[model samples]
Structure formats: C-alpha cells, structure tokens
Target: MSGVKRKHVTLSLNEKLAVLQRLDKGESLQQIAKELNVGVTTIKDWRKNRKDIESYTITIDGENALKHRKTLKRAKLELLDNALWMWFCQERRKGTPISGPILKEKAIVLHKKLKAESEFAASEGWIDRWKNRHGVRFVSISGEKLSADNEAAREFCVKFQEIFKENEMLPCQVYNIDETGLNFKMLPTKTLAASNESVTGTKLMKDRITVAPCSNADGTHKLPLFVIGKSKKPRAFKNLNPSSLPVYYRNQKSAWMDCNLFKSWFFDEFVPSVEKNLKEKKLPARAILLLDNAPSHPPEQELVKGDIKALFLPPNVTSLIQPMDQGAIEWLKRRYRRKYISSILEKSEQGFNIFEAMKSLTIKDAIYTIAASWDELKPDTLRKSWRKLWPEVMTETDQTEDQQNNDSQEIVKDLQTLDPNVLASEVEDWITECDKDCDSYEELDDDQILAAVIETDNKETANEDSDCEEDELPTRISHTDAKNAFDIALQYIEQNPTSTPMDILWIKKWRDTAAKSRISCAKQKSITDFFTK
Candidate 1:
C-alpha cells in the first residue's frame, strides 16, 4: 500500500468546487483527498481559498470548458482577475485599444503590481479565457490615430493655454461647437431573429440628419440644438409650427452645414444665446467660442457685438485635443440610441409594427432625444474630456469615471436581458460605432456615403419661383390635415392612460390652437377664382 502508484488527474473547476463544498460541509480535507485521489494539501488549499473559488462564476463557454474537463489555469488567479477587470474597464473607457498581447503584458504587470507569487503565469490560453469572462474582444479601431504627433499636440496646447489665460475665462465662458450626423435608421445589427431567418434585414440605408451641438466647459450652457435635414417640410411637420419646436431647423439641398448658414447661426442664434446665458449668470458677455476649422465654419474674427471671440484649434489636432471629440458627443449618441431602442419597444407594445414605429420617428423626436442626451452628460465627463487637449484644466473632484463604469455594466445587462441571443461583441460594436464621431466632426465630402440630393423638374421650377419678387403669403394648414392631427393627439392621450393632468391639458390647448389656426387659414384655391380672377 505504501508503494502503490496513483494516476495524475487534473481537477476541473467543478471538481474543485465539489471538493470545496464537501470540505465546507464539515468533511475532513483528508477524507476528500482520499476520496478524490488527490493529496490532502490540495483539498486544504481549496478550502482555505473558498471565497476566491466561489467568486469564479462560470460563463456558458466556461461551463462548456468545464464539461470538456478543461483546467481553470487563468481563472485560478481570482484576485488578479478582479484587478485586471477594473484596469481593463478604465482603459476601455479611455478608448485605448487592448490587443491580446497587450493584455497579456498588462496581466503580468498587474501581477507584479499586486505583488502576487511568482507562480502567476498569464499564458495565451489563460488570456483567451479571461477575455471571454470579461466580454473582451478585438475590434477594429477606426477614426483614431494610434500615435499622434507629440510636438504638434504640445504646441497647440501651449497656444490654447495662452488664449485661455489671456481671456481669464471661467468654465462657462468657454465653449466647444461641433456637428454630427444622426442616421435615424441605424440600428444595432444584433437582434433576436428566428433561427432560420437572416439578421441582415436589420440594415437599412436610411437618410441622415446633421445636428449642431454646443456646450460650455463647466457643463452650464447646452445651447438649443440646430438640426438640418434634406427635406424642408416633412409630411409629419405639415400641421406643426416649425418655430415652436425646441430645436432650430434648417434645410439645404445637400443637407450639410455651409459657411452662409454658419455665419447666420453665429450672428442670430449662438451670439444671442451666449449673451443671455452670461447675463443670467451675472457674468460678462465676453466668452471664448472654440471651433474646429471645418470648411462649413465662417471666417469671422470679431463678433458683431459683445466681446465674444472665436478660437480655432490647429489643423489635424482636433482628434488629439478637442473636448467634444474626447467623449461628450459619444455619450450623447449612446443615450440617443438607447432612447430610440426604448421607443421601439414602447410602440411595439402598443400594437404598432416595429418597422412602422421606427418610420414614425421624426426630426422632432431626434431633437428631443438629442437634447435630453446632452443634458444627461455628467459635468465631470465634460471636464475630463479636455484632458488630452488641456490636462491643466481637469479637476480631480469628479466621480464620473466610476459612474460611467457602472452605467456601462448596467447597459450591457439591460441589453442582454432584452435580447439574450445578442452577442457581447455586438454591444461593444455599437459602442465603438457611437465613439467614431467623437474623433472628428462630420465634414461634407464628395466621397461621403450620404444620400444624393434628389432633383426634379418641378423642384427646379419651385426654386426659380422662390427667387422671384413675389409677395409674402400667410402660411396655412389644411382643415382636414388639422383635424387629423387633433385626432392623433387625442388618440395618443387615450392610449397612454398614464398621461398626467398637465400632459392632458397641454394636448387640449394644442388641439384648440390647431382648430383656430385652421379656421383662420388663407382662402383656398377655388373654381371661381380659377375662372374669373
């Protein structure tokens, strides 16, 4: 018996757990070792590290690994796993690319940081398992240079510091203005489709809208959004007043921001809004408006009034230094996409076809969602985003980094619950898509994938007529269209029984206004006018 040979067998995580559970239930480690054909010290060590053993939640693939009798080589480093999890998320939030080799090196570094035993080996197999456990995968990096010119970035930072110090500008006195395109039809390519059905149907080449958003450094001033669309008057807007909407709307043949429009926005919208914001805050009207030198931006050094001045970032430096590009716009897009998904679920629940519900998403809906998204941005996010460009301006008092990490976990959880078949990589892909625009503004280019400007003979004739010296006629809505709008509002109120009293009152007032406006409409084209006049 003393000379009997025992076969060497590796225990899987489950076997390890079983042995540990037996030890927990008052069974002696010696008894488990004898029964499991292992040394007593192996059982004793498993019992001593029960917390670490229990903390290792096996994933579906990990469970499959256990079924195939795979050893938990990397998973055994529970403390290192916990530490690496935190570090990985932080790096991911900073938009840092973590390749397999880079992560392996980091794991080795973290082991040294944690001062773990020299036995901690981060093998390639362990790295793959670790990635699966943490939902990490290699994604193609887009719209960012892996390496930036340090000298150029430093020179721009110096220039920014000078301008900022010269102006003695408060956080609210400084601003960043940028534009992005929202493709309303863009949906996450992941969905819970029938097993036999192709998921490629989710892709739609929908039209895009350009949105101009501006925010101050202190997160105090989020100006009203300026949304540009190809259609000057959408059918959804027929019975509505454009000026009454929360966003300022504009139309262009190309649906792109141009110098003429930028100039008008500067004088008419941006300047006035800043003045009013400053007045309310009891600060001077003087402020610094930081802009990237895009072709659409007008070249105006001096303001028509007030001491507000425009500062342009050096060419090719925006990705390295722009605050909005760092994270603000990315947060807005993520929030907007979440809202869009929420709307789809809500409308689908109310007996509407999902496609039809998505089709009903108008520019008004986009404006509201985009504005709310901008408002939801943590102030710390705004300040920290400037770290690349103006690290000196960053403050240490913000808990946004932790909050964002928590929020991302919650989002992944919610999305997984919504569609269990959804891939973790798909969620990450959606996030990467959201982050793409943060690197640069959407400049109009000849090779852009945007829709071509649709032209027709009738449209040409209308454009010609628009240039004529015709008298200004009062705008009017058709009585039938007005009635239909009122009915739709009433139906919405009826369907949403959760509507508050204030909501009902607003609907009533809107309906009454629509009715009165229809009554006061200009004389309709009549048969008598066609013959006599």
Candidate 2:
C-alpha cells in the first residue's frame, strides 16, 4: 500500500526571516527542513535569495505585508501606490482626518502626477485592498476622550466564557500576550540631600525599549521575550551575534511596537513556540491567543493557523482584565529594577566609580537582565494574574495581593539602600515611571513622522557611515584565557569555606563547554575561504 502524500507548507515573510535567523546561527539546511516539515530545496532557495528577502523585509510596506504567505507581487501601479502612501502618512501625521473618498481622490491625484503608462481608476476595491496590504485603519482623533466601557467588558467576559466552553479550551491551551515600554536607563527622581547641601536633579535618561511577554494561563510555557529598540545595531552588540541573544530583538525608529513588528513576532516566535510546547505536554495542537485591541495588532482573521486562533479583548477594558496588565508586567519591571540596582551596588562596593559603572550599562546588559527576570517570575504569580479575567483558572495556592506587596516593598528597600536621598514614595514613582509614556502603540506626532521619513530616505547613507563611528570591538577571549579565568575562579572557591561543591562543579563544566566550543570553531572553515577558493 502507498502512503498519503504530505501537504506542503508555505512560509510567510516573517517565517522566512525566522528561518534566515536560524540559518545564520549555523543550523544545517537538512535540520531546518526537518523541523519546518519542508524539503531541503526550499531552504536552499531561501538561502540563495537571502539578500532580496532581507531588503523587502525591512521596508515600511514589507513589514505590514500579508502574514499568511509570502507575497512578492508589486502593486499594479507601483509608483502611484508609493506616492499615495507617502501622502497618506504625511496627512495622518498632520492630524488631518481622512475618509475613504478622500483617500481615493488623493490616489487619483497621485496617479496623475506620476504620469504612469497604465490606466488608474482608484476604485473602492483597490482602496480596500490597499488599506489591507498597508495595515491602515481609521482611528479616532480624540482617542483620549474615550474611557473604559465597563458594560462592554462585562458582556465580553460572558461571551468569552461561552467561547471557552465551546472550544473545550483548558487553562494550559489558552494564552495571553501584551507589550510594555521600558525606560531601560531611567533613574529615580528623588534622592536624599545633606541637611545644608543644595540638591540638583540630573536629566532623566529617556532611552526606551519595548518588551512583549507571552505565556499560557497555566504558565507552563513562556515564549522568548520580544524586544524593540531604536537602533538596528547598537554599539554594545559589536562582535556579538544578535541571533545568539536571549531575547528576540527588533528595531524601529520610535522603539515602539507597530503592526509590522507585532505581526512578525506572532508568526516568527509565538506560533512555533506554542506548537512545540503543546506537543511536549502531550496535548492537542489547538490553542487560543488572547490579545488587546492595540492598533498594532492585526485583525483576528489574519491570525488563524491550523488549530490556533487569535482573540481580542473588548476595547478599552485591557487595563481592567488583560492578564499581563493585571500585575505580570508590573512585577517583571520591579524584578528588573531590583536586579539592575543590585548590580550597580555590587560593582560600587567592588570599588568601581559609581558614575562610571552606571554609565557603562548597555542594551546588551539590559536584555540579559530582562530575560533573567522573566524567567524568575514564579508560575503562581502568572496564574494569579488571570483571576480577574478567568477566575476559574485560579487555584487555592495562587499568590495573593499581600505576597506581591511584600515583593514591591523589598524592591523599595533596595532602592533606598542604593541612594540615601531616595524616599519610599520616590522609589514607588520611579518604578512606574516607564509605564506613563510607554503605550503599546505610540502614535507618531508630526515632527516624529517627518523625521522618520527623512531617516528612511537616508538609511543607505547612514548604514555606510555607521562603520566609521562604531565603537571598538571588544577583544575575544581565547580558549586558554577562558581556562585560566575558570581556574582562578575555582582557586578562589577552593580557598573560601562558603563555596559549595556545586559551585566548583559549575566552573569545571563551563570550562569544558568553552574548550569544546573552541575545538568546534577550529574545525569549521571561515566564510572568507569559500570566496577565495
């Protein structure tokens, strides 16, 4: 008897990027092909077209392209579409209200201006498709005037419960994801002053990054952290491979989450992680991913896969019932701040100049610390965060408000210890400082939009000049140097009575891994050899 033929899988642009990232990490074509359930030839084709794939993947239109499958087709009237999109962005940035008819008229004008050889009607069908392709939507100008609709939230909860029962979804099969802004380098606003000393405040470091955390209700699986920053290549990452970083890092001019980035993250990270986790737990591949109505989020229709689907929470009620907003994000931030402060204090005690130490903090350091803090978030804390939205998921042993309060108090105490002038109230303010301006989808102002346009135009020139201004690459540690450092640490631990047997064992294990890695690297020929040969 013959076996049934396997169906083919078409990868989206986001998925292609994920595949590229894996290949960059030196995964073999066969290995990736097996994992993705595709043939090696497909992987080879992607590798061959890597440059074109990367070029399209970074453009404004490219980011918001279809998420279901790869679409390399240009608009029937490419020049007209480009001009129309640019005009639309300019008007939107100027806070000018745009209607469908207005857009169509503008498109017609642009078509005429471009003097394209092809005829252009700018019909309603074309407008609708264009909007979908670009991920454009009509939004309220006075968004601030709206308030949370409690009645709607209550109704949605009942509807949500019905869907939950109908789908036969377990707590482990359901997930929630949200994004929060981090002022990664911000310090406390209040500090202690000598009785007779004049106190002056330094400017706040507003350097920002956006972090998106995802986990199932049971907290059995936490997806890799997705981070967005202002720079594509930060100086601190020189000589370091970004693909090897703990978190999945992306970049935008505003360091904010947008439709393109979110869509990419959904397909590239969330779906695969969830599918793998479900398989490991011996559960069905079916699941539901709950999201808020952030403007950046693609519509639910676009998010459906084989057995997984995306569901949106009722508008404006996210603050009340969103799982992450309930306390998960706040707790993560508090944990991150505590870890950051502890690092500074530890180095200061080691006799390093405090100012220099603080100045030395880099995006790379912040990223590793964020990953560590997320890992440290207890499962109980995550499960309890769902109480307001899905009370039945709660257990008798779920963490309580008092326990969380105690954690906050501990962080406050640490802050106070770090700066004698810092008050409990000040620490409290500082902890929530990033939350104030870090909306998941920050609308660009007129000036910001203009600046972004300019930046996009000059991106190639900027990339060319970046190398000349980059910081010196950090020196690589050789295998011998690594062994010596490990040996020194082992010697110190042997002399210290407090050091455990496990500590010595960890050092030796690290040494072995380093040695093995060095051997592996020595056996692989450099890419330069291929071209030279």
Name the candidate that leads on lDDT.
Answer: 2
Task: Report every candidate's CA lDDT.
Answer: 0.63, 0.72
- Candidate 1 Cα outliers beyond 4 Å, as residue runs: 1-147, 192-203, 300-306, 391-396, 401-419, 434-533
Question: Model 2 over residues 1-533: C-alpha lDDT tens digits?
Answer: 76976578888887887787677667787988988899889888988997676555433343345364385656676556655665665454334567777788877776665556778788878987777556665423443334666877788888888998998888999999999988766656443232222333332333568899999998888887899776788777767877889998987666778766887787788888888988998987789999987756655655755568889886668888889998899888888888877787777678764454455677778899999999988788899889888988888888455545665677677666656666777777777774676655666443444444345444321231232133345577887688778888889998999999999999999888877877777666465567689
| C-alpha RMSD by candidate, in order | 29.0, 10.0
TM-score of each: 0.55, 0.68
For candidate 2, what is the TM-score?
0.68
Q: Against the true structure, candidate 1 has what lDDT?
A: 0.63
**What TM-score would you give candidate 1 relative to the actual structure?**
0.55
